[model samples]
Target chain A: MTASTQMIEEGTALEVDGLVKRFGDLTAVDGVSLTVRAGECLGLLGPNGAGKSTLIRSMVGRVRQDSGRVTVMGKAAGSTEARMALGWVPQELSIYPRITCRENLGSFGRYYGLKGQTLKDAIAWCLHWAALEEKQDDVAKTLSGGMKRRLNMAAGMLHRPKVVLFDEPTVGVDPQSRNRIFEMIEALRDAGTAIVYTTHYMEEAERLCDRIAIIDHGKIIAEGTNEELVEKTFGRRSQVLARFDGETAAIEAWAGRHGGRVKGETAEFTIEQAGEIAPLLDDATKAGLELEDLTLRRPNLESVFLHLTGRELRD
Target chain B: MIALKRDRGALVLSFVLPLAFFSIFAVIFGRQGGGTPTVKLIVVDQDQSQASAALVKGLQSESSLVVMMKPEAKSKSAPAPADYTAATAEAAVKAGDAPVALIIPAGFGQHPIAFGPDAGGSTLELLNDQSDTIAPQIVVGLLQKAAITSMPSAMADEGMKYADKYVGGFTPAQKAKVDEELDALRKAEADGKTGAGSGDSGNGNSGNGSAGAGIVAVNVRAVVGENKKSPMISFYAAAIGVMFLMFTASGSAGALLDEAESGTLERVLSTRVTMTKLLAGKLVFNTGLAFVQLTAMFLWGWSAFKLDFFSHLPGFAVMGLCTAFAVAAFGMLLASACQTRAQLGALSTLVILIMSSVGGSMFPRFLMPESMQKAGLLTINAWAIDGFTKVFWRDLPVTDLWPQVAVLLGVGVVLFLIARRVARRWEFS
Candidate 1:
């Protein structure tokens, strides 16, 4: 490999340290730091106004940080070299509505210095990748919301940069298109392109991200793998929920010994391990508690986000 | 109430701007109904004689003429040389320094003013640029009135000179008879009576001489180029056409702000293209749009009013292109300065209405007060209208439009530079 290519491979594909951006008195992105390795997908999860967009913007050099630094592929952010290596998909639909899909892709591709046969090839590939080959000649305004969102992604990815950032790419898309977008992202990741995806959907983050960062109030309050975060926030405990057929004052007395609580005919028990669930059920049965339904719940990112931030993931 | 508060700028412009312009133009064109509008004339008196002085003073006293000339020096010992000459006066008119130049030739006061079909009538030459159709006519009419008003005195003066030369040698009795006959003729002419006096029998030979000497005529000659006559309808058509063209160009230029709001501008900025190049592309497109609009309007005028469109196509094209470029640059500057489309609309409307009102688009600048006429020179509309007047009214050659073209293109370049600086936010914001 060339020395520059080898050097890029040795460092993180994207790195941000102590990045702070303020608008007037509000710190939009407060001293946030993160890194994404090559071929790894880092999902940025946050509620509205959680500084996710600001952080993403700073990473792409769209907004200058008040402090600290952001670098892409070993180059400073906002530099031409860094910009040439970065791809961004903003939350809003940024395609030209009056132009055809093919023309929109071609125009954006040219902005990236793609021209001649290379530009045509990129446009053709993006049309097929976005599943818009048939509708390539139609004006973007006439497309459905899902189609436009897909096209928005396709436009950003035409350059095939080393680092790609998507800011809430599937906010208002249909389920089918959202799944397709997820698949497309997965393909990018498998192709060894580092990705930073931001979304409010926890399930999407849990399924797609290799590591997830939960941000709140302009700070990354928590960052880890899904299981690591769950264990760190809530310990290795599982909850067993039992609905009784009748009122069970007797079961409440037995379950209180095992760190469980009873409300009316339902009993909820927090156990240290999954093996403890059977013994608790045996005790409940011995206490003459007639159970109608029982379910075992494991801790997840949603609960971890709640446990760490004391708020829901989407709040 | 919410909508009103949201669009307060448009609200203010819709009501306040119209009322303001109306009050202004009403005061300007309203009082013009009672009296003839004055024409600015420059006079060069080559003949420094009594008759020439009297003619100049008489024209100066006329309400319809504002005479401008170099004043004589105050020192009687060392008088200042005359700075104004016939060539300079003619040049002044051609360069639009004044509407008309009235040159009194040498020896104009020596001969008797001729009123009838006399061959050697003293001619007062009026030189005009012909851009102004109405002003020249007014000047000509004022000259005619001045000549007619001075006729009786001129006839008496000639009659006295004739009596001194020919009748001086006559005998006292003969001279007394001739005097008695002249008094009777004067009384007869004044009493609405036309009959030869009874002394006609004795003074019949001198009667012919006295009668022939009493008539004086003045001829007024206009020096103007061919095809310089422009009808009032055609003038207004061109004026109103350019005024609305500015409005339309500004409106179209507002599309830049729309694109910004829609995120397309931001998307384009994210590309490798620099902001300056993008703005330049937009300027070119808007300028072309303005040019096409003006061309269509002129074509319609040609079909409707028989305006000389094809005859002066070269000059017209130059004027249209330069004016379009300036107007487009102006519109883009407004767009770049304003943050929103509504603000652009209101502010551009206010500016264009004021400029059009003061710049001879709605009313002739010649009819405005002198102060307003000077103020009109500060607007693009003034230069644009002046250029079109050269092509359509004066029928001037294409080369003559260079001054207007230079000013317009220069303004366009300057405004585009300012717009480029102001529009940097579109790339970074």
Candidate 2:
């Protein structure tokens, strides 16, 4: 079979090559490049205004880049074949609020040219996949916040596209609802569907995505598996966590002087050797600080993410 | 206050709508174009006599009446059109050429005045369109005035003949006095001081629409809409139907703004559908909705009002579909031009209300001054209402609806094209 006819969830499902999109003086997406493989979930991590949504929009063919190439399932971006193969769940709740979940799915499916029995079956399958079978007949707005998010996602993939881009699918959702979304993504990956997930929640990226890419100012600054990124950023190193009893300002000053960061009551520092803890304690004691408890742990995706991206993700 | 101040759309709608409506009404009623509309009266003089000729000249002299003997020539070099006969004059009234027609019989000069209240023989026939209530009354009142003031010799001779039949014969002295009075009247008429110059008496309707005339035996006939249960039923059906159709279409078209706000437009565009296809789909849906609305409105008109709707089906269908297409395209244009629901609501209300008021939906265009009537032609409401009036009121055939059809279809095409162009903003980011 030719590449399009194959429709197999193997190899490269989507690719963006040297994409550049400028809006007047601001470059929204600049020279962004990546490959999303089938049966794998790629997490996109970015702080506010970091061009994550723009890059995803460009990949979904909702945006035209000033200079770039984007291919979906071996077809050029914005082509009929590419549009048919790609699914985009927008950052906003884009589903029709006045319509039933099934109807919303049916409307989107029809846009993709599904019809009759085929459309009905696609809607049914989407309901099951979104874990919304029981609420299929309910209007989308009447659903819970989490249910609305799932319906939005379900409408995007109603046609069973080989590649799907989920942009902040779990935004404003509770923890329980977010876990449900994680399960949904996991199920899709198990079924060999290619996924590009975007979120500000670092733990979601760690839990759902097989690989993570961090974009900042319209460029991909980092990309790898969670462990790979942490190792690459700070190789063979560990983070030391200590809770201190002292004035908040003094502890923060001490943490900042030692090339460490204070998060709430705890001060954290990365060290290559355990012996470095002795000097850290010695400095804390000299500063008239008392350590309540301490723990040694490896640096995580959050640390690596902030180390490269600067501002807080939610900001 | 702050929100209203910041929302420019609402602000404009609030201040501009009332002012615009007021201005439209002022222009229509304030006599800015002219004080009173001149009545168009067709004159057919079968009587080739001095008295009938004088009467024609007299009616022509009135500033408030436009008396036409024949249709205008197509061009300056074209042959003069034939004068209207009794048959053609009546047909003109039926076809809405002139609201009232005066047909002087062949022997009207011999018996111009009827001293008796109900005297018969060689009477004048006044053909009228009942829909224009004021025109017929004005014609009737002025016709009698012309017969009395214009022909002094005919009135004298008729009075003598009636006296000779009823009373004893007139004396020589009486005869001599009457002859001297006739001479003086003839001299005045010869010097152009008689006829229309006798008086500028006809400057308004005769205060009543009913046909009541004196000094001449006259038969009044409503040549059009005489059989309908009520006048203005079919008129209001078309008039109000088209006005509401405009409002409904604009509201329906505003659905695009709603979808855009909700982000469904972007999401749908990301699918296999292109912008053109999306707009085309909306156009079709809006057109269908508008057509259905028009059908329902007319059907309601038929059931409630005693309008003769069944016989005019073909003409209604032609006008209805064309009007529907135009209004639907109009809605699309409004939607495409506006960026938000608030803007669409404000803009559509302002525009549709102004168009309706100016286009004769609010009142008869004939009641307005000539210039305002011409301006009314620029509105879709005017064209659609005119077409329906031809079908239901004038009973014109479907073939006669070509002008309205051509204009409405053309407007629809142009508006739809403009809407398609404006909708390109939503195609991509």
Candidate 3:
């Protein structure tokens, strides 16, 4: 194995130490620190305005932190060597719309000082990786939304950097395209590339992330594997979700009396075992509540996010 | 309409554009500060006689003419510069320091007027810049009136001398003839006269010695813009072309704002490309685009307006490149100063239009008031048009373009540096 490849395989590909970023009086990232190793995907899960984007931006060298340090491949962030080793796919569709997909990749590859055969090979690999071989020469503006998003991702990764930050890359894409993106990311992860993925979707984190960091108000409140987060927040417990057809105030009062959260049309309760759901339903029936629906499921990332922040994942 | 009302940029372009245009047009074409455009006239009184002195004094008395005998003093208490000679006066007109110059030849006051068989008098030479067609006519007409009104003794003495040489060589006889002619003119005027005085009101070369045909002979020579196949073609090309080039440059530079909004700028910064390098690339692209726009304009002028483009290619290229660089830098500054595309649109339009109007694009700076003409020097368009004028109209060699080239390149560098400073916000956070 090549020495550079070996080093990347065994080293910390990305590291952030006490990164503090502030805008006016609002601290967007408050003394946050994390590390991503090779062959691992770290997903940042948060609700809206939870500082997930700010943290990712700081790591990518797009945001200048007021304090602390970020290093890629053991070099300082925003330095020439570090920049060459880092790749950022912003949440916004950042590719040039007037140019074709191949041209966009060529332009970005040139920015990274790639040329000739190397640039051509990088373009080809990115096209194939993004499943955009057929639309390689099509103008980005004319492409479908998912294709454009894929091209945006491909442009940032043309140099094959050791660390890649994908900021909400699957936003606004259809199901099939999201699946395609997931497959592309999985391939990158299997190639031993350290990746930071941020999304509001709970399932995406559950399926792809080796570890998940939950951020709220510029601080990481909980971080672990999906099972670990759910276990940490709600141990040995399953959630009881019941929809009762009754007066809104009466249902809210009954759920409150039973120590359940009435969110929208459903009442949620954290039970240690599945057997506890029968008593809750029986209590609901005795309170003159007509049960419309009920679900017994293990607690998940969404449940953990809710239990920790008292807000929906999409709020 | 509602959208337009809400968008300040569109609102400014809609109402403020017309108002700005009107104000500039009024300041240029209408009366300004209750004063007329003062013509700059350099006077060289070689004869130094009574008639010459009186004529100089009369021209100085004219509020519409700024008559200068020598260049301005360097300091408040410094020794005055030498008075201009005939050669220096002609050079001043050619150098565009003044539109017209009057050089009273030697012995002009000896026989200022000639109306005999030998109407031999030293002609007062009026050297003019052909770029300003009106200044020569105004100078010539004013010269005749000033000579008649300011130097009546010189006119009569010459008339008497002419009569003595032609008729009887007697003062009494000459005086009697002049009185008889005056009585006859009075009678003709009292009878509602028509064509009873003179003819050939232009040039006054008749030597008829009649009223309105002029009393003094003046030689009018165009010291600049004399050999042009067409008048003001190069001036128009440079003027109008530079104005639109600014628009093209600013609009092209607005792409930076686009990339910033779309997040491509952020992504690009994450790569090895720094903000300085990105702005440099954009400057080169914008400069080339402006040069192409200027070339197309001149090529069209060459084909249609008989612009002397082929012979002045070297000067044109130098001036064109410098002007494009300066304007591109200006665009970059505007783009970096503004936060959004709408702000850029409004600000660039207002600034470029104002610059164009004041910089000799809408009208020649020579016709503006002296203060406005001096103000024209502050804009890139003025320097560019001046350089192009020297090349195509004055037929000057490329070496003469150093002043303009220096200003434009310096302006470009300074503006680019400022733009780079202003663009730091996009570099991080």
DockQ of each: 0.43, 0.77, 0.83
| Candidate 2 per-residue C-alpha lDDT over A1-315 given as tens digits, one digit per residue, 9 for 90 to 100 | 776445344588988899999989999888999988898899999888888887888887878789988899889888999999899999899988998988889899999999999999998898998999999889888999999999999999878888999988988998898888889889988998899999888888888899999899988999999999999998999989999999989899989989998877889889999999999999999988999999998888888887787666676
| lDDT, model 2 | 0.86
Model 1: how far residue A233 lies from native, Å: 2.3
Per lDDT, the best of the predicted structures is 2
Clashing residue pairs in candidate 1 are B113-B217, B114-B216, B114-B217, B114-B218, B115-B216, B115-B217
lDDT of 1 by residue, B44-143 (tens): 8888865566567666767666788853466778777566688877766665667778777788777636534443546666676544656666665555
Candidate 1 lDDT tens digits, A37-112 = 8899999987788898888878777786789999889888777788788888888898889999999999899888
Q: Least accurate stretch of 10 residues (summed lDDT) in model 3 chain B?
A: B194-203
Best-matching candidate per DockQ: 3
Candidate 2 residue runs with Cα over 4 Å from true position: A1-10, A241-257, A261-268, A288-295, B32-36, B120-122, B159-168, B195-212
Candidate No. with top TM-score? 2
Clashing pairs in 2: none
Give the least accurate 10-residue stretch of model 1 chain A, judged by summed lDDT: A2-11
Candidate 1 — which residues are off by over 4 angstroms?
A1-7, A239-271, A274-295, B30-34, B70-88, B105-107, B110-121, B144-152, B158-225, B228-241, B298-318, B391-403, B424-429
Report the C-alpha displacement of residue A206, candidate 3, in angstroms: 1.9
